[model samples]
Target: MANRVIIVGGGGGGAILANLLQPHGFDVTVIDKSTSHFFQPGNLWIAFKGVSPEKFLRPIPSLLKKGVNYVNDEVVSVDLNERRVTTRSGRSYEYDFVVLASGAELDYSAVPGHRELLERFGDFYSSPENSLKLWNTLRGLKEGSFVIGVADPIYKCPPGPHKGAFLASELLRSRGLAGKVKVVLAVPVPHAYPSKTVADILEPELKERGVEIHTFFTVNEVDNRENRLVSLEGEDIKFNVAVVVPPHRGPSYNISPAEVKDQSSYVKIDKYTSNVQGFDDAYAIGDCTNAPTSKSGVTAHLQAEVVAARLLGYDARYSGRTNCPIITDGKGTFVISDYDHPPIKVRLSRFKRLMEDLFVATYWSAVKYPEFWSPIFKAYFDATDEFIRRGEGW
Candidate 1:
């Protein structure tokens, strides 16, 4: 009989792992709270390009392989000792191996007055409806300061706040409001980005585009009454329109032996193997794991590959690889790095921008049929490896 594998939270990592394992003699079941799989990267396009959110959504079942079981229900808890997962519907699943890919929860209420700010000004980082609302609010803006920043330092997509600022700057320029509206990007970090190499390359471009960069501006509260953002540093930034990426936490489901998770509730996993600290039969991936890497889909995808390979009895280990696309001035490049290296300098180009846009079209297929696409993806990764190692520009 095949080994029974139960995956929690059928997001990118869970779904991809299921697809990769189902055909390799594993009985894979994926449980998720939602029926729809959202292509999260498209949120920026929705906010900036006015793209419909529907274009980025697909049924979760449709994205899974036919042999994989899809359960649309909330997980209540997981008993690591029993190797059983209990759901809200009172059903229990026994698994020989389990993987957690629930991703991170967006906790807007973590910040005081933030929910009210979302209701009034809208935000792109939350949901599709909110992304659309943000675009509507932005298109109507005639002038004044347009503020974009992060409320928390550890939200998904480290470059997202900067992407918003850059995209908004371009949109305002297209709308003939560039001169009237000030694009201010405030970050909690001391640099424009966490990676000094990448930050150095991006800072000059931001200045050239006339974007105001405020460093060390960690959000303390959104003062809706005063129409200002108060920072922990005691600085207040007034804005005509604002969107702050909210705080993120791990899954709400209770995990037995609370020591499996950290103070932030993110699962404590071996960064190399993704094995939940003490349990070799269980693993965690994606934003839910306290891995030393950016919380992005690419990290999850690569980790999924490693987990699948290990489960199939092949020796595989995740090297903390991540590739995040960064856009500015309507062109794009990537921040590609691994445990052994920081991001190599890559020049922005239209081809890279096109590749970034093209991923949207292939994302579903890549998730649903990993075996078929593995060769092609291997070639891509190999090329990127050579590029990064040689310190060559693309």
Candidate 2:
């Protein structure tokens, strides 16, 4: 009998794992709360650019491979002792191996007044509704003190707050409000970005655009009444327009399972292998694992490949690799790095735009075009990247 593999959370990692394992004859079953799958990376585009959120969304069922079981339900519990997973609908599934890819959740309660403040303020981190609302709010603002705040250190996308500030600056400048508007970023990190090499590049660009950077600003409370953020040290930063990234925490099922080690609500796993410690047949990938890496989709994609290889009887170890583009106004820099090496910065203004256009086209094609396969799309992406890298002569 083939291995019965159960993958929780049909997001990027779980969806990719299902596609990879199904071809290898594993009976893959993916469970997700939402029936629709949206390209998360495109959320930024929708918020900053004028792209519609509908363009990035597809039915989750359409993304899965043939013969793969799709379960649209909420997971109630994971009984590691019996290797069983129970859903809220009372459905139980026994699996030979399980992959916890059920990513993190935003903890609005971590910062007092965050939830209530969002109703009147603005944020475009995850929710589509919030992204659209933020865009509407941004378009109407002609002049004010725009502030982008990071509520915690372990939030998704370390560069998100920076991008928000940069994009806002561009928006203000384009509207001829450069002199009338002031932009400020309040973050917990000691630098604009975690990677000092990348921070050096971004800091100057921000300064050039007149965006203030307040490093080590740990926001403990949201002063909604005063339209300001109060730091842990009791410092206050006022804002006319506020956009914040809320704190993140892992799913509760893993902690309640009593099988996996919990590292501050995240599953404790071997950083290199993604194997859940103390478990022989269980693995945690993506944001759910307590890996000392930025919880970005790129990291999740790389970790999924490692998990997939290991399950197929190969010695695959997760390489702490990340490649993220800090794009602003159709152009920007690329921050690429691995665990063993420091991050390398590359600026390819035109190439970045070209890649962005090509990706959106290829992404939707992969969904609608039957012959435009993922493997083929990947080959095209890899070849185009190499071609551009060599063409730039960097």
Candidate 3:
């Protein structure tokens, strides 16, 4: 019999793992709580502008193909000793190998009144509700200190909020509302973009967008009392609308303190194998683990490939490198990272920069759109879905 491999949390990693192993004749199952898959990388874009859900998400049922079974349910607990997973629906399933790519949760409530802050001001880093909230806020906002602030660092898509600023500025200009909107970006990081090289090139673009950059401004307290987001410096930026990007933390489930985890409760896995510390058959990948990579769809997809290979008894030759073209109004920078080195830098043409934005738009759309429906989405999704699909004749 082929090995029964169960992957939990059908993010980019799990979804890709399923496709990879199906052709290899192993049994694979993908389980996620949410009905739709989202291209998470696009959240930054969607907050400022609008993108169709159809272009991104694909339903699991059709996308799972013939051999694999798609369980559209939340994973509540995993019995690693028994090699079984219990979904929120109260059903338990077994597996020989388990890949944990459950992903992280947005810590919006880490800030008080954040739920209301999101409802009134909108937060771009959380869920669709927040995105839709941000969209509405962006539409009606005019002529006030419109602050895009980060609560903390370690966000999934680090370059995302800046993308929000870029697309939103273009949209506002297209609507002739550019002069009416006073935009300010408050970040804990020193540079507008993390890398100094990219920041230097894009600084002018930000200035052109009427975006005032504020560095070293950490959010101290959000006073819904007066509808103001206060900074650590006690300089209150009263806002017509506040777009908050809350903090991110690891998965909090089925975890024992005995097992290794990061300070943030993120799964601690070895760099190459992605195996949970002290456990051989159990593995975690993507944003769920502190896997020495930026938590994004690209990272998840890359780690998923390695996880699938390891499950199949191959070395899962993850050379530990991935390249992402970060889009910007200026000729954007290429941010490439590998295990051995820091994120590399390359400057691309203006046209190529535009292509990067388009590619990212298509890439992070799965939460609401499933993988099976759209051809463009399917092409990008199929490029990575590597897992064993449950099939006939064992």
Residue pairs in clash, model 2: none
Candidates 2 and 3 compared by TM-score, better number: 2
lDDT string, candidate 1, 1-394, tens digits: 8899999988888999999998888999999989999989888889888999999899999999888999999999999999999999999999999999999988889889899999997787878889999999999999899998688889899889888888988999999998999999999999998887789878988888889999999888998888899998889899999888888899789998889989989999999999999998999999998998999999999899999999998889988877898888668888888888888888788788788878878998899888888788778888898877776657
Which 10-residue span in candidate 1 carries the lowest summed lDDT?
385-394
Cα error, candidate 2, residue 88 (Å): 1.1
Task: List, in order, the clash count of every candidate structure.
Answer: 0, 0, 30
Q: Each prediction's Cα lDDT score?
A: 0.89, 0.77, 0.70
In model 1, pairs of residues that clash are none
Q: Please, what are the lDDT tens digits per residue for candidate 2 over residues 117-177?
A: 6777546787777787777777877777888888778877777777788887887888899
Q: What TM-score goes with each of the models?
A: 0.97, 0.90, 0.85
Model 2 residue runs over 4 Å out of place are 254-259, 364-394
User: TM-score of predicted model 1?
Assistant: 0.97
- Which segments of model 3 are wrong by more than 4 Å? 232-235, 256-258, 317-322, 329-331, 357-394
Candidate 1 — which residues are off by over 4 angstroms? 390-393
- Every candidate's CA RMSD: 1.3, 3.4, 7.4
